[model samples]
Target chain A: MGKRSFNILDVTLRDGSHAVKHSFTEEQVRQVARGLDQAGVRYFEVSHGDGLGGSSLQYGLSAVDEMKLIEAAVDECEQAEVSVLLLPGIGVKEDLEDAVKAGAKMVRVATHVTEADVARQQIELGRNLGLKTIGFLMMAHMAPVDKLIEQAKLFESYGAEVVYVTDSAGALMPHEVKERVSALKDHLSCEVGFHGHNNLSLAMANTIAAVEAGAAYVDGSLRCLGAGSGNTQTEVMAAVFERLGYQTGIDLYKVMDVANDVVAKIMPRPQEITGSSLIMGYSGVYSSFLLHTHDAAKKFGVDERSILIELGKMQAVGGQEDLIYEVAADISKRNKALV
Target chain B: MGKRSFNILDVTLRDGSHAVKHSFTEEQVRQVARGLDQAGVRYFEVSHGDGLGGSSLQYGLSAVDEMKLIEAAVDECEQAEVSVLLLPGIGVKEDLEDAVKAGAKMVRVATHVTEADVARQQIELGRNLGLKTIGFLMMAHMAPVDKLIEQAKLFESYGAEVVYVTDSAGALMPHEVKERVSALKDHLSCEVGFHGHNNLSLAMANTIAAVEAGAAYVDGSLRCLGAGSGNTQTEVMAAVFERLGYQTGIDLYKVMDVANDVVAKIMPRPQEITGSSLIMGYSGVYSSFLLHTHDAAKKFGVDERSILIELGKMQAVGGQEDLIYEVAADISKRNKALV
Candidate 1:
């Protein structure tokens, strides 16, 4: 086997914010950042779970300003670069500038898979600021291979340094991941990456598939601390990559220590594939919809699975949270009529 | 895209016995069996975790006699066949006869990957008793593909109906599993099967790889209720098989209900890849070595990871429980000398 080399982008502070409801304190961010930096992590993402400017009532307010959190991580890291995730509509030009000022050296401009055109301006802005710019195509499973290739090419044309097949719903099988990532690697000149969630317990496998298909960069979090069933566990990924003869440049023992001693302590609950999250993957709904669907289900006294299934049928994507309530209400109304 | 079909042999009562310390009560057995049978599970294995006659001072004692538990499952199941696992030395010819008398219609004669010859007598005995005989090559990761094929061929020649590439250590990667199972499928006349452990978090992926490589029978436990981090979750496998266009003959909703309603409640703790278990997978130690290693580590005041790594270096396989203590004591003595 070839000694394949790749980069590990740790997203614990950014994507993990959703697990803690965007309430990561400065000290916690600094501790995790410092630990991962010592473990030889090359890139560390820090932001609101939904990205910059995502701390409002709907997305849940941040305990500390994301700029402060990013600065905290930046102050702790010696070798690792701090990064941020910026969804197109939620995070505007000023937010990107502010993130760069807070010492974020990379920015992943994320968009719904079908709407890569919306990320063009932000991708160019990130490059202008001299940040390593990446275009993240979220919910990559919903689109066909050709559509993904087209979107990835758009990212490459916009001067993005890398494009990712982000399995936002954790709905993809390994072969599907291979097909989509292989197509992007073939069609685009920029490096390809993959971001995975564990809603269906396939995050590690899908990330392995992405690497096998020539992904140059991949996303993981300490203890799998992300949305839904969380992202792939960073330490486990480091161990597996080492076993597979991939050059991740990560100290496996150090990463494992960080995961156990630092990140595991702060987690509210161990991230397992719960019934709602499993339904999310099975139905192709967005990962972040988990909490909202639970609340809606409880309020309407309806099953969460029904709400998720209806949303899946409607082909819901991220930021379409209002549909959760609508689906729940409809189910509740039908239940009352039956009664 | 082809609609491939495979048999899902539920081993919750057998392998899951390890998680519960061989303490499955008769009622619990009946409940799980009835639930899975109602959900259309084709085969249900019931025995001590280490197979028949495994309950002793060395291996934890069974809460109830396994024969009684097997009879309980047999009574509850209407369509699902009751199966039992029998390791040749631990379970002699008499245990197979007893299992058959207790209504077990199938028996998997298990052995170390290099010791398949030991199962020849038990395999023949199972056939004579009108049992669906399966030859289980435990720790198949320790052997090369050609070696695995040769051993599987021996099982086929001995009249075993199926031969399994059993990853008792949870050590094989997806590609490795594919190679071994594909080789057996090509060379053997009998059906090929796969049994996976989730110590490395690759059970589902490895099982999928095995199925892709022409395995006709696959093993899973409800809610991943087996050894180490557990086996592949049965309900999740059913959902994934459905998503991958594979015919599992399982009702997805029914299986999910059984997992959530029946199995989850009985589990002492949720089976996530813990630190010790992760080391087991990383070091290629047997999955069942988890609790024994933990006990040895505590008694010797040594690190569990060190014990597991030493075991891996020695290439320890199943039924090597004594080695865990030996490794732990050696590390303890070395530490004392340094002090």
Candidate 2:
């Protein structure tokens, strides 16, 4: 195997939005973007955690307009290219156009692993607009290697420059990640990337496995400031990459300072594997289901873990959050009967 | 390779003593010990964080007599056998004898990787006292494969039933752990065990790697309650082992309940990879140096990371904690001169 070069995409402004309930102010975006840019990071993703136009009643509202946050990050970045994430149903073409107007140079069009066709229009539009178009298959672990390759190929055919195997549930083990990433590398014409969550405390290890299996682009957030237990921590990933003999072009000391000084201040709490999050990972449930599961568990008087495990058994996907209530109510009813 | 059967040793009452400042009351020990025993964990280690007789002004005093805590654990446990750790310099033979009287069925004689000779007397005494003698080589990352084998051989020759490749610093990556554990497994006659810390957030991954490399006995603390980001979490490790097809003989839900209901209440704070602890793992410094580094940094007005890095460069061992202050003072003096 040849040595593979990897790019670190700082997702603190994008995926991290979920951890903070989409409450990043424009100034916070500017601070994190500027610090990461100065620390030699080449890519900064800025958007609502769900995607562009994701701020609404259903998915928590953004504190500041996401367009303005994008503009702030784009303005603060001197060397880094700003990126935006867009899921087809959550974010529309207008949101992508506005993001481009706000100076986003790349757009990662995200869809469920088996639903790549929904993102075709956005991938084509991103290519036409001269932005770096990347296909992001969320919950990639839900599909087998062949299915992942088939979906990734669809993205490449739709003009995506890169394709990512996204572990939204943080459920895939290191060997599983390697197998998926290697399959994509073998089958996809476009560059392969990986986005990992730390719900199972394997984000760093899974990212390493992806890189070793030929992933060229990977995602991280400062201090793991994403959803659930958050993404792979950006500063620690840089340090680990350096130790692993990967040239990430990130200044280790500068990134560490940014994580500790800038990002740590705005974080509501340190990202950790709480019981709910651990159960989410163990049950292979969606990362965003954490709060919903907790709420349903409380409202229905059921254990949050039982709800998550039931969802996993049902093979629930990202958009199936309504099932949380169903699962909780069902568990509560069963327990009452037992009593 | 054939199927591997692994045993998890819950160290919540032993290494976790460090995270709580040796403050486990007798009742708390009984609760955790009984819960784990009921959950089918076969081994429970109870002692001061530093080892037997380690409670002192230097290592911090135990909240209750360790002998009583051991007795409490022994009294509560129906299936699990209580174990105690004895570092030769901190815990002498008399302490081992007392621990045996308190119903400790096993004694892990700990010494630095290069100083296993110091633990020979303790190992022999434990064996003679009808205890299962295990040799614990702490800070094993500081030595190469040959040195580790040489030291582990000393323990086997001293009548140890098992030898451990202990990552006390939490510095070794998964591949590095695989190398060390495989080396020990290949060279040693006795069974090999692994003890890990989560300083770099790789405890779970490193422990997995050790198991893959043929380690049979592994250590974990409930909720990762130990020094410097704590050890591999016992509940989480059991979950992962189940996923990996390893029969750990641990009931997952029961262990999770023990962690959440019994152990979580006693945790002062969640074990996390703080900036100081992250730097410790990155710099390969001792896990116990976190508090001292923070104190020295505050006193001398130096960055804790700098002190840790300097200590890593000097290859400082466990007993050389005074160097924390010395390094801090040197950095402070140099900074002042430049100013």
Candidate 3:
């Protein structure tokens, strides 16, 4: 096979913040960003776990101001370009400007897979601010390939530099990834990326399938410390791309060191396919609901899987973490009556 | 896509033995087998971590005699056919007969991917013994597609019922799995199978690729309780297959119960891609060597990743556990001198 090349967007500080309850110290961000920069990872995502303006009661507050974290990451990363995530509903134009002012060089405007229409203004604002704009289609597995293409076209029309098929629930199969990515690649002029979760242990494989189907940017986290079973592990993906004869440009050993040293220390818990995580993937619930569901399940004395399955049945998406408590309480009451 | 039907061979007992140091008690085997049998898994593999006669010094000894475990599993399983692994060098004809006496209805003859010739006698013996014979190609990622097809043909010539692309290191990409499984399916007249590990967190994705490429038999373990990052979780595969509109025959909720209740209790550790396990897949070392390498590294006070990388450099295949000690000692001595 000829050497295939792609860009890797490390989302450790952004997505991984959820796992640590968004309590990443500025020093933690600096250490990881510095290590990743030295390792030649060109794109680094740093923001609140839920994106700009996401530090609130429902989403859980960041221990440190996210701007401080982003600024620290930007200052420490000499070669790597800092990026921030912004969900259109959760963030506004001012928040986007604030992120840019904090030295974020790129901004990913995210929306639910079918809600790309809301992302148009955010994408436009990001471009107007002179930051590279990416359209992130979260919960890509919920929509079919044709719908994904339609969404990608919206992002393209809005001047987004890249569009992603983000498997937020980690529910996608390799064939599903292939179909969606190939569709987006064919329909959109901009680059197509894939972000994967490991709730079902298919993150790396799905990411590989995405790359094979012509994904231009793939997201990973060092040690897979993102949400639920976490994201596609950064070091593992580097090794995989290297083995597949891909020009990743990043040094594999250096990334592995970052994962082992800096990322390992900051991890709240090792990412594993726990019962709640497995249920999240199995039920197609959002991966970010893991900790909230676990806490509610424990508090209500209900099985976390039951809460996850109920949440999946309701088709709960991101920013609906309150549903976790409601579902767990209902399930606990039902179980108590049975007892 | 049309609905595709496939067989699931649950290897929770065989491959999972390594995780428990091959110490699966008779009751544990019986419980898991009964649950799986009730869940409609047609094939069950129960053996020592290595094979029939694998309870020796080189391989860890089982706490209970494997025959007792096999007999217990065999007696409890109502519908599922019991199978045993027989590595050519590790197991002899008498061991095969003993497994048959213990009520094993099938036998998988395994060899290194490049060493299929060693498996010919075992396959022939299994056929003559009136058992359903399977040819297991271990460490399949070590060989190229053409070499794997060449080796698989040898198994077919020896009258094997099915040939499996067993990813012993969990190192295969979905495309590679597609190439190998598709090749075997096209070249061999008999059925093809794929067994995956989760070291690269690609077990489910690789399995999906194998099925898409026309593999008829796929293997999984409950809760992924096997070597390294463990085998593909059985319940997860069932859920995935069901969602993809495939006829898996196994009950999804029933298997989930088995995973949550029985298999969860038996696991020594939940399988996640640990640093050493990641090195095993990155280095393409044997998945089963994870525990042995960790033990040697700890004993020698060397980093397990270094030992794993060195072993991978040596291209150590399964049954080469002794080399782990030698390499770890050398690495420890080198680090000491440098210090």
Model 1's CAPRI class is medium
Q: Model 2 off-target regions past 4 Å? A: A1-3, A287-307, A318-339, B287-304, B318-339
TM-score of each: 0.91, 0.93, 0.86
Residue-level lDDT tens digits of model 3 in A1-339 = 667688999999999999999999989999999999999999989989999989999789999999899899999877899999999778778887888888999999999999999988888888989999999998987887888899899999999999999998888877789999999888878999999998777888788889999998999999898977899999888888877789899987788889988898888677777666777787898756878988998999887877888888788887899988999989988998999
lDDT, candidate 2, A1-339, per-residue tens: 325578999999988998899999988998999999999999989999899999999888999999999998899988999999999988998999999999999999999999998888999999998899999999887888899999999999999999999999898999999999999888878899999998778898999999999899999999899988889988888877777778899987789888988999999887877677778788998766778998999999887888888898788986788989988999999999999
| B222-298 per-residue lDDT for model 3 (tens digits) | 98988888898898888778778899999866788888889888887677776767777888886568789889989
Order the numbered candidates by lDDT, best leading: 1, 2, 3
The C-alpha local distance difference test score for the whole of candidate 3 amounts to 0.88
Fnat per predicted structure, each in turn: 0.38, 0.36, 0.51
Report how far residue A324 has shifted in candidate 3, in Å: 10
Clashing pairs in 3: none
TM-score of 1: 0.91
What DockQ does each listed candidate score?
A: 0.52, 0.54, 0.42
Tell me the spans in candidate 1 whose CA falls farther than 4 Å from its real position.
A287-307, A318-339, B287-307, B318-339
TM-score (C-alpha) between model 2 and the true structure: 0.93
